[model samples]
Target: MNAALLIGLSLQLSSCSNDFLEEETYGEVKPSEMTQAANVERAIISAYSVLNGQIDGASNAFNSPDSNWSFGDVTSDDCYKGGGGTGDQNNIHQMEIFNANSTTIDIVRKWMALYEGVKRSNEAMRLLNASTDFDPALKLKRAAELRFLRGHYYFELKKIYNRIPYIDETANTVADYAKSNTIFTSEELWGKIEDDFKLAYTDLPEIQTDKGRPTKIAAKAYLVKCYVFEKKWQLAYDASTEIMSSSYGLLSDFQQVFLPENDNNKEIIFAVQHSINDGQASSYNGSIGDRLTAPGGPFYAQYGFHRPSKNLVNAFKTNSVGLPQEDNIDVLNSDKVDPRLDITVGRPGIPYKDLGVLYSTTWARDLATYGEFAPKKRIVSAKSPFYVTVWPYVNALNYYIIRYAEVILWRAEASVEINKLEEARALVNQIRQRASNSTYVKTLDGTANAGNYNISTYTLPWTNSIEATAAVHTETRLELAMEGHRFFNLVRWGEVDSVMKTYLAVEKTRRTHLTNAFFTKGKNEYFPIPQSYIDGFAPGIITQNSGY
Candidate 1:
């Protein structure tokens, strides 16, 4: 099971009847009391465990996945909430249509799960600081690791909630977490997340003998991402160039990026490691939250909730010379498209996952509402040992939180913003070069290419920053489509208003469910703070985002 054993053995907290910010402990030994060397290490492992976003007693894991699929992908022009029908997990459907509110169970659970991560991180650091027998050098590394993880948890929270209670090791119990989301300004909160990453970059080793631990390069990569979100183009470019110069680069094939064999391969900067058959009867140690995407037909499991949209599929279209087409044209099955499209989305006749089974249009659970294509990432082969046939249809494939390609794209974006057009074009071309050389999806007999796989790199230098920025953005959407990054990327770029309006206007003509779906400009930029948490405190004790 590799590092999955850590999650299986890591200590977990019991859910209190109140908000997740308030947690009660179990047993006689408090986190401070367990200051032995081995226990301190155990606490470190526990901090990493929550990154997978699995709550022991929570059944609706889709409400809060570490992948950010629902919050990031489905809400944008990337995908749709495809299930048996619209009523299935309607809260997410509401979110998909931008009808979100403070009490969305999905939003509530996401808040709970993120806070649980903060809780574990605080507990682990407490143990580390309290430990009297642990090795000093190892304790420093472990503490840095916990800081990176807690920074990660808070980063996701900030992206989703905009303003969140930034808890750290200083807090211990439920009473200690009475701090409000208003204690720090938005800039200050960003600084706190940045500070953790900076300290982690200072202390963490360049390489780890273990899996899932953040290395110095990983911390730097996260710093680049934080800078990207804050629009600090110079800082993003500087930090991202350092990572690009490091050992990380694109894999020869894009498909290999998500393969189980390359779970923590050289390309992956950080990921929440998943494992199956780990002796957990529920198999929650695996990619439990992503089980709904299994697009079942013959041997595959049957939820099929995260189906790719027609808009996203058309985005893969390539011109005759192999470049992204202008958005005005409609793409067809016979169109000359990018090679990465077939590898990304499952078309009607393309072989799914290189398996002998040809993907049938009927594989889509709800064709009338959602499109025919299903998510191909995060899915493993049926013959693999990691695939488990259970209610969740879980697998051991690790969900990549950050990969080298993303860092490259971030740098490209930063370069374009800083007027380094040629450098940005070269950066985008680097990713495209991998896609052009990479393998395409196989046919039914595995004798030939599945579709018209035509993709090429930028042969011309970009002289215009505006066009160059568009190209970089398009390259990112094509390379990282359906990986739960589209919406957040759009939001950070401040293009959600224009893009969603155009997308909803056109998409409603195809999918009837989006007829009334709309995105309110400033308000929809972020979700509302969960009402329950606000109710638990005084009127001004906790602050809520505007337009809630």
Candidate 2:
């Protein structure tokens, strides 16, 4: 499908409520009529559409906040749940403090959205299998697409709640879905997800005619991610190596990768497709989760949430030779910093965007609580011609799920795990080289150089595997800062406990809200399974995770 048609279909599918899952028929078309190829294709489109369910208004409001922003960023040390105040979105504040419970609304909402995705994908698989009208080749391709999406949904669930029910096409009824725990062991569940992605990797073409659809390379990249999560280092290394040999490459400039004009660039392996003013009355098709992250007041009329932390801002500071001064906060006032900082964050006195206005402290809603920096990567300039005022805060920017740089970084990580230090350094340098090209942020009249903007490749060779691993981890945090992967990355490295505890200790001294924050190693690693799911299941059928 073309981008325009996909946008229209996205809006149409999003309009269906949770009731759509229970309904025997879709509109006037009965389940019997769904045997036609066209209807089956629509079913497939609906499955693909569910991938955007994490966006605000795409699903129920209880889960309206994207977990990427909540669980991924705010829960980590990178961001604060910046809204009206401490009382605003207290559930999120609970998350920031490692105090969220099973009944937390965000947890319930994220669970529902991910399972809804699983259900839709399963429905597509059943429809495709029952339909006789589709060409055999097309059927195989579309089936692969459905399985890829299924694997993607399961992957999200797996990361959030380590143990979950595995439902597929055969488990069509609610009763069947309720028996989730009995069906597979946790290891078996990971194997099942891997099976789907392996099928997708084997069946999907290297490239797709549709811009948003996953390619074979995209499936391979995700498989590498899954292996990394499972700690299957050799498998991750093999899969990442295959992806590195693909046609994808880094965009020369880091800032351009997220711009509206470069939405589906070569750098992106898979992205959640978004379009503005595609006849949706609200911001359903736009990047709505990011609406609150834009500068407040005159900069852009919106709520200011997901404020970047001073710690994150400090992470950009580089020494004389362009290596990160991880512990030297005193050097921040005088040190050269990575150019990507300007691209990722909006600090005081910096150019906010293409707009001439300098980012001021007033742009932050609560300077005393959240730090001074505003998020910039996904924020569209209100002054730009591409800016859509119909939804004012939302825009036609695609949210990248996997990019080539990430693939390189994953390979680098895998290399370090397997003691391939030289290979890891080369991969990390590939990303830094591209970041080095992102030298300046443009102002209305002229461009201003980002703080120092003197990033360079690692000059010193890795002394050992552990040193190389730490370098790869730091590089991942800096390169993928606010894109919502920090907490998960730290967790996968088994560093979240130590890292977050130290982070909170120092951060409390800076931001008073974090004075009581604490991170327990085992208990805080994953979120509690939503209480509603447990209540819905038969007694003793759904066991909650360790802490909650």
Candidate 3:
């Protein structure tokens, strides 16, 4: 295809169309027409565009349309589907109660968006391989990028739905995707994803000229994450060691990592890039999805969703030495807490960004149903330059997929598994120390510290590997709270059933919405594959996950 036509196709892919599994052919520009190097480059850009799935409008509900927030945070113990009530986004409410079925809209939407991403990546590889005229070196680099993206989409699919159709560049028609056993075994699927990342790691450059593009280091980090998920301790450690040797390191201030000015900084290994006032019909380039998570009042009026849960807030409680008070809830109100809690959550008396007063309970739309807390990580201040008045509540802040602190924690986990407890403690300490330095959130008058912030690193030796591993997991939860990693971490560590069941029992007393919540061990681990995928195509071919 010519460059303009290729760009047009990319725009079509990014539209809010719901037709996902169907193949829409652009007038076939044969291999001969795409001989120019620029056309090949445009084709690669088209593949990247699919990363931001369909943007329907400037609605906060679909801001990160393909994100895991609904499943990763709301379904876990960290958050609630904060809105008008259980009737608001009722499908998400079903998911929160562990009752979401295959026909649920959220499941269908997420499934289609991810499959569309897979299709676009496959198309890009097919077009790139067809062209015989582009520079061989450039072709290799583009191929590696596409492979990384394909692996990423599949990884998301594998996590959400254990059995998914693996469509590569060779699957050219709907029939191919409809074939029986298109769903490979779990081991085979992970292997496919691992191979793709390995290729990207070997071929990608150390850095990229553009800010949003992935690098060899990013690929290495992703590979480590893959190994960590599979419990392959030695492989995870080796890959993490390589990433730590790179130029990236933790940002000195933990709060700065989320601010708009510090986007794509040394701390972030890879993130979804966002831009404000891009002149698109909708401000879809910004992170409008999280706009509702901000406190609503005369200051910032918006939909209030994804409110932080009371259980998550309580987990931040720290003791005199700055370690978690795991068994004591009575100590929370009076004892010192982790400094990162003030940065991650908005409580009744903490300052609400640069907008002057302390966040009040009145900010929540229905405090009786959800809670008195708000999410603060992805929110932007009204006075910040990243704030765009055109899309009043929307701000162009990037969402991190992986950061350096996460890499440190992953390395720590791997070390504990490999019997290197001291190394693991040191890695966890690095994250805690940075959080301790991030204790700048104060009262509106700036005269007193917010919520008695206090955090200290692990100084005593771990008694055993189990204790060391538990410490690493708790640190991970504190460091990466509300960033859509909680449920996934729980699942990988085999702690979801116990952790969530207890969470529901305790939280039901505070928030009545979760009174009926229960998490089954085997079935609740992955969401049901959408029923539309089974009924619409290949009736008996696509099997459903258990207890759907």
Candidate 4:
């Protein structure tokens, strides 16, 4: 009922705790009572809680992780699906290889989790709209927050499944739920999603006391992302301009930005707040989806999933005076590269964090299959109070969905598309300059720099839009690597076909699993709709994607 209790509710929602729903109850607050302010806040918390992608009955929440690790990272050239073996979580491996079909379990489960968030958000909005007992002004703000959440869930659904149903607060009945995925055109769906965020921008406050609540700035940033995905360059730039004028800016230290202690720092506009040992049963409040992402080094749990690829490792290579070498023939260890590489990945012989233990090949779980590199950014220090060393090794580190730096790059991208090449270059230079200023990771003895760090910002002019565009895209890949944005970035830019072709060509030689790998651009651009859900409804409720 109080603020503190509401914060706890946001961290862990009891409404979503059941492993299996009993026949007698739906395990939800009664819709009639949801009109009360106390219940409204609780309902809102329930919606926010699902953003972490922790479904109790779902065996592996990683299938539906809000972070999009499987769909975004493994699907891209950035990572390999490293786990127990080839057969382990094979649904994801199917996605990794672009061999997935409609029945793929990962696709189904991700669809379910995203739709669940949409349902919870819709329920909150319905209650807020129906409530006369609540303060009118506060009710509007709360509804805007729920709408923003709805926009996010819909955004994820739209990205993965392009022709999804646009269900809203009014669709309460069983028959209403049967609305066709084709009810609206793809453009219309984008408009509806934009409408939600636009409303949230108008109503939500500039600041919120709740750690994970969407402020006006957060809504505006999401707008920029939506525009960028839609390729509406002018709209994206205008929104990003407002965000730039705001107080949000980069943190001085790049390495410190990802640490748990800086979870909700100024640099991060929005993130899914993970809480360990919270009141939730079974510690599901922690990093359920990301638990497997921990690289199996000493002072860290040993799952060794989400291994960084050699292609990604080589991508860090820089020429003399700190410029990127786009397909450089440089060995990983001996080459000079960006300092951010050491912070983002754990290679053999580099000190893993500040734990005083050097990362070794022994830490790698299937080194022959996945290579020696492991994911470093997602894993927190074992000594951190937020870490849980239990079976799944869940932690309390928040996954950033939108950071200020991301918006800057998005703005840079928009500027280039609008022929503002010089503007885009300046924006990208901001990101590179920060990377140059950030501290380099140290060796095990703390006496020397880890790897050959020599990253710096561009001093030369981006002569044309093509060059500027390439620079921005490359910077985006380097700046946001391993954060589950790579594949989507390739998709939005229409470069997946060429990029993946080049990646698979070389990667097949390195790893045998990729020997037969290929990406069919049109067919692979978006995943097919889950067949089971379509079957649950009428014959024409949901149409499959082309070539499915």
Candidate 5:
């Protein structure tokens, strides 16, 4: 029997959920038993199905193929780059965003789905532990796979909504509540998350027959991430060093990493696997690329959602010397953009060979008029109601939750914390090298299209180097924005002020473009914990984050 098949065998044993669990199916399992191995294999696919497009439950947000629009719709620092709106003005869904109630819905959906995933994983683990049918060796491997899935899910939950109730076991009753009796403290919970990942690293095979499942390397990469989150810099550096030294170097082409054909590319440390059969196909074109690129066609238009911020589009443009244009240019013009401007955002005139045989750009006038229909960067077409109507790319490209490139960046950032600048620069340059044809350009004057004056200019660290460090950190923010790193990176750096402030300035500067949306400092940083959870658990027991 194939070892890969063995890895998925225990998923077949999931029993039907009772009426209570039924009420909250959340896509983890079906009521009927899956008796056949083929059906069981399908269940494994179903496990991946629950990995939603975005943690926010706003579909197709941040699954952008290219960074086109600013995600300013959510924060004052940014504004909607894409255009188009469903005619249903009565739809309260978009309006409810940022409200305490709306945030609660996102929290509930995320919490429920994560719990469902954990429950399914627990069932698989239990069956693998008790099964006598499979060979002992194969059973152990299967157990590792289930544990990895459970740990990954738990980690994701904890990271997104801190102080969440941790359910590691198969809870058959209310008495089985870990949060009530055996709960780990917030600090201890991080340790538990780390331990599970560590065990997953040990028991899981170094390589797997399946492309989507976690391997030892994926566990290692996540371990590094966990360590960084906890501020364990040396540990993160060590784990990252292992990944860098492993057989997990980047792919030959950076663009291929996001291509449909490159779903499980070598650069991917961990990705929520999506397939065509289970709703993945239903939401294919509504992805980030679709919204960004499909504009101007009868089939698709209303492009410019996730529109690249001048901060980010300018990020990719380099002078002839390889430095970003902002650093050296006297004044940066939006139109006198970088070559990467085409690469990162879909404009009317830019030719994207990767998208199709066509070369096109959507004019500003067209975007202002028809951008409401555009979902740019999302897989969904501009015509669909599910267009980039929400902040972030709401596409179904299966979230690359963690990639080796991020691991590299994390290491660099952590190194900076530990007073290691050269290491940080090297890592940042590694990412730049993949995006550009040449070496790391340090001088700004040589950036592609230097004549454009609208872009900003800041010198790299020549003396104090802190400015350069700040620039590198900003670069990470620009390069990875709305991909879901902006808020967290701000939190991690103790620099949420700058990000929020910068975003507000950008919004104010573009007030005519933004209309009524302006960012406020205290309110937007961390999302308030769900009022429902607080009301259910206890306002005193499970307190909300401050100022929520």
Candidate 6:
């Protein structure tokens, strides 16, 4: 068979069109295709396809007020105020957290998307195991890719539902559901993910790839991140360190990282590819970027759903030069802090000179920006004249899952955990240099006011290995802000309680207009696993998460 023929077989093995398996028989190739390999490889791409739908568009994930302050919907980090309190319905970020009736459709879609990915992957594995017609080397590589994609989908599911019914090739008849065990220990599931990634790293290509496929680098990068999730710090360090030294390096200009022109730029370890021409039509993809970014152009300006918090803005604005904005400043000045602030945060009326767009005060007026003002989170827009349209969806900005900057920080953190403090300090300084525009900032060595604000000294204080592990992880919370890593990172590091008690509770109280109606953090850790899923399966084997 020709290369195209083999590639076609891979497609048949994994393509999204269910007709491939339903209407047609196995081993049958289309007019343009010939080999089983082509169809099988296509199946792998199907698995990759699901990542495009995982993100919540309007107010589900990062766009929620709880995550960002500009939306003004967050009650407390831990609790939802009400379904209609702020812009809860309109707030895409809050929708992901609260599980409202109107927004459950997207959640179901996400669940279905993941299962589709798993089904395609299983079919591919089944074909490979049964066929001797495909080339052994190519077959192994394709299989590895499928496994990686499957594990990735599972990891995403794990995060959202935390103990979703684990399914693999073992799933069979409806009656088989009773015999099947969906209750997998977290450790066991993480083990499966690690193994799949290891196989992927061994088989994937080291060089660059097309828009959607996972390169060797992407697999390795995610492996490090997952390792961090599993508390495998030393291994995470080793994996991230390799990527740091590889061809990947920080882009000289940070702004380019998000530009449409730089969608598949070298610094990106892995990102869900979206095309301007023929992109995924799912709500998660098209037009969301333009909607959030346009501020007030034609596409529609819903209050920039994802706004920066005062705390986050202040954190990024620390003196970049390590020197006070003036002389021996008692408190940190936001005026002369990290330069990335403007790039990350969008304040109303703040014009971004590079992008040639000004933040409009328009989205604030639109109730469509988030959900019904909810007791849980508030959805506030900047107030724009334009109305939110449900047509011709097209999101321009690339949603990055991992980047060179994160990999660098991951390396720096691992270095410290291994007692390589000097190495850790050097990596941390690299980030500071970019953030500060080339100033030597103080190390976290408990030194007295080494940089800008002499008001307080910053040093990591953790008694045990676990606590120290958490502190380094906290750096990730600050460093990787709004890229959708906060809540999950908190859960993984077992620091959710601290974030709730110390940060969320105080932040909520500080912002409340009515002192009597307050939010708390007691019973809001994991979201209620979609009730529908539990009801469907026999014996109702799928149990809800704790405190749901």
- What tens digits encode model 1's per-residue C-alpha lDDT throughout 300-372? 8778888888898889988888899857356676788888888888888888875678888888887898878
lDDT of 3 by residue, 1-548 (tens): 23222212223533221112112323234556654566666556655554555523325335235446787899898899888889888888899999889988777766766766676677778878987787899788889998888888888888888788787788765555665535578888899999999999888999888777789998889889899989999999988988888899999998888898898899999876766666544555566555555557656665678888888887888878888876626324466888788788888877888889788889887889997888887778877878765444667787788899999999999999998899999999999888887747887788978777777888999769988988999999889888888999999999999999888888888888888888998999999887777876658888788888
Model 2 TM-score, all chains together: 0.93
| Worst window of 10 by summed lDDT in candidate 2 | 1-10
How well does candidate 4 match the true structure in TM-score terms?
0.94
Candidate 1: 10-residue stretch with minimal lDDT:
14-23
Candidate 4 lDDT over residue span 280-360, tens digit each? 656666778887887876666667789899999888889998988878353557788888888998888888887888888
**What RMSD value applies to candidate 4?**
4.9
Stronger candidate by lDDT (3 vs 4): 4
How far off is residue 353 in model 6, in Å?
Answer: 5.4
lDDT of 6 by residue, 242-309 (tens): 78778877766655456555666878877655443332333333323223332333234333333334
lDDT of 3: 0.77
What residue runs in model 5 are displaced by over 4 Å at the alpha carbon? 1-46, 53-104, 178-184, 277-304, 315-321, 325-339, 353-398, 438-465, 511-523, 534-541
Query: How does residue 377 of candidate 2 score in lDDT?
Result: 80
lDDT of 2 by residue, 225-293 (tens): 899888888899998877777888898888888888888799999887766656655646566556666
At residue 422, candidate 6 shows an lDDT of 59
Q: What alpha-carbon RMSD in Å does predicted model 1 have with respect to the real structure?
A: 5.1
Every candidate's lDDT = 0.82, 0.77, 0.77, 0.82, 0.50, 0.50
Worst 10 residues of 6 by lDDT: 371-380
Which of the two, 1 or 6, has more lDDT?
1
Better of 2 and 6 by TM-score: 2
TM-score of each: 0.94, 0.93, 0.92, 0.94, 0.72, 0.72
